[model samples]
Target: MEHDRTRTRAWVLHPEIKSDEQRRVPEPALEEAVALAAALPDLDVVGSEVVRLQRAQAGLLFGSGKIEELGERFHENEVELVLIDGPVTPVQQRNLEKAWKVKILDRTGLILEIFSDRARTREGVLQVEMAALSYQRTRLVRAWTHLERQRGGLGFVGGPGETQIEADRRAIDEQLVRLRRQLQKVVKTRTLHRAARAKVPYPIVALVGYTNAGKSTLFNGLTGAKVMARDMLFATLDPTMRRVELPDGPEVILSDTVGFISNLPTELVAAFRATLEEVLGADLVVHLRDISHEETEAQAQDVETILTSLGVEDDRPRLEVWNKIDLLSSEDRQATLARAERDPAIFAISAVTGEGIAPLLSEIATILQGARHESTLSLTFAEGQKRAWLFRQEVVRSEEQTEDGFEITVLWTDKQAARFAAL
Candidate 1:
């Protein structure tokens, strides 16, 4: 819709197409769509519904009768925008806008809008621009369907044989090319920064989860950085990193990443990948979950699926954070804590109340410290290089001189141990 001072009244529709092989439970899905609508700055969501259908129509998506009925409702409410919480074809979008007499946005467009509003960094803005351009490029299809088609002609004949669609596509392509170049420069700068961070000995722990899953809150609690920890979806679009020295643990760089969602737009999946590169390079990944949400399990599965799609290896070190336990009932909280305690990889914590944080931090420290048990090393007197290296690394706990060598005890991280081995 129009970006102005006045709010755009919007309606949300989640189509539950029965013919589709994968179907989300409609009610929560509808709620999520409404939340997505609410995420935009100028959109005021007035009403929402879960529309059940045997199948989606190819041209208009909804049936004629249904369209007319919805049109009447829109007229009654003065709805300026209709947000369909699914993939709407360009043809269907055009036809529905004609029938409903209002602007229509599918799931992708709405997400793109929210991201556009939330992006603060220059690189983030460029990425969003590129993604929105790509989406608009695809939508160029049906808008020019009614334009005059060019027939066979020479370079100077028949008005150069160029149709409106081709011109529009060409303009969008040019815009995308320029945006890509700008984005590459920004990315290169970030790569240089990442390289500098790489030289530091601190390990990186990345926070990743579904939108509004308390990742930002946990990140703030751990690092003491005042990141935007709002309840809104896609609240944090750009990555924020901070150094944290854990209690009785090694120092680490904590990275807060943009949250994942179900059915993310493919364009964004590619465009925003650069922002998530921190996750790929992190030494420890913490998958935070809103354990209090009704559809928590489903949301966790969606996050897992996205992580796999992003090529996060199965062998990567990861921890499951069951956050927001303060929102749970006392009994459920106890049960969750008990369950988490049973699994070393799972931690139940309330980032708001700071409950269970000590244990989680201790665990992170334990993991970052590599093998907890100290290793004994036999170094001959002639092996002064290795002996001096151990002392320089400050991992030596104790040393004893024997007849021909020295016996040393050391505590070190896996990375340090590996470096020593390489030397």
Candidate 2:
């Protein structure tokens, strides 16, 4: 299989629409798109450019002269695939592909391809498949010549005159239904596992950031679990959790989740919500930023946008983890350290060399400490099981016996308090 693989020659283009209100700076966006194209193993990026546009043309997405010029570049470079850095309508995609005589993939399509290639766990694979099918269902336009063919059906079902497009759409819909059913079962099992974890006294701390922002590296450093840590985009597709013990704090469940990207497809965000439940349920979320990157602030904004869309409560405890400090120059590092010193909410650390890790851990312990509260409760003698459970959890800081019942004071987290109430 490895020997049979052939790399496709690809060209990436970022459209710079002057009238568009939400466009990022063209150069960095183009660089990011090129990196996205390179993330696929079987793609050799031949060239990339930022195409200036006053406004998008509905039919072709670019002016005729610009289209012809890009076509010439594609021909000169022998490009087999063209990746657009933004959304392209179905009609525009079809027309552009015909004009350039090469396959065309919009930003959403490119992301789906990368996800399909990188998905590892069963749930991740299923979610990617569903998202790809949802995206494909929308692109079932006149792009393919085969869509002009007519398919034969039963007499009761349109009498052998169904267009190929209808048949294909129906097939995709059927597949989506099957995939949804399978996903439901998988999600049900996952929910059960999460419930089990909720019974434990450990708090969950989830690591989230943009792709290639050193989240997996930090996770490995803190938990000593060998997850796939690399400088590649989407290197860690599935969520990985491990038990981590802090110096003066209780053990915690540390989770490393999929990285967020700018303009992530809505289908993907919806499909992977279940995979990101760890982040939503986390007692503390650590926003790990690659402080060395030029667009670190913009990347952090993208992460926050996605988190907001995922319904992460605004009041949830959060910490800003400025990772990759080792990549900074001495002067820049000093500035970062100064900034961190002034802001108790931020911690600058290098996951590779373990620099500032001890202090970061101490900070995490402090934050977790803030989540705990002490409460006094009165339970009757009949509630022996609940009493035993509380004692087993070692949360019984103080206890007293009264005439009506035994009064107990327990120092515990909100999760523990909820569990005790339920009992």
Candidate with the greatest TM-score versus the true structure: 2
Collision pairs in model 1: none
After superposing candidate 1, which stretches have Cα over 4 Å from the reference? 1-5, 142-161, 371-423
Off by over 4 Å in 2: 1-5, 143-148, 156-159, 369-423
lDDT score of model 2? Answer: 0.88
lDDT string for model 2 (1-423, tens) is 132238898999999999999899899899889888888989989899999999999999999999998899899888899999999988999899889999999999998898888788789999999999989999989545663487567887645878878778888999999999999898888877776676566778999999989999999988889898877788788899999999998788899999889877777788777668889878899999999999999999999998998899888989998999999999999999999999998999998999988988888888887566678889889888899998776567678998877899876778778888888
lDDT per residue, candidate 1, 235-347, as tens digits?
Answer: 89899999999998888889999988988878889877877888987878999999999999989998899888788998778999999999999999999989998898999
Instruction: Please state the error at residue 162 of candidate 1 in Å.
Output: 2.4
**All candidates' lDDT scores?**
0.87, 0.88
Query: Which 10 residues in a row give candidate 2 its minimum summed lDDT?
Result: 1-10
What are the TM-scores, per candidate, against the unseen true structure? 0.84, 0.86
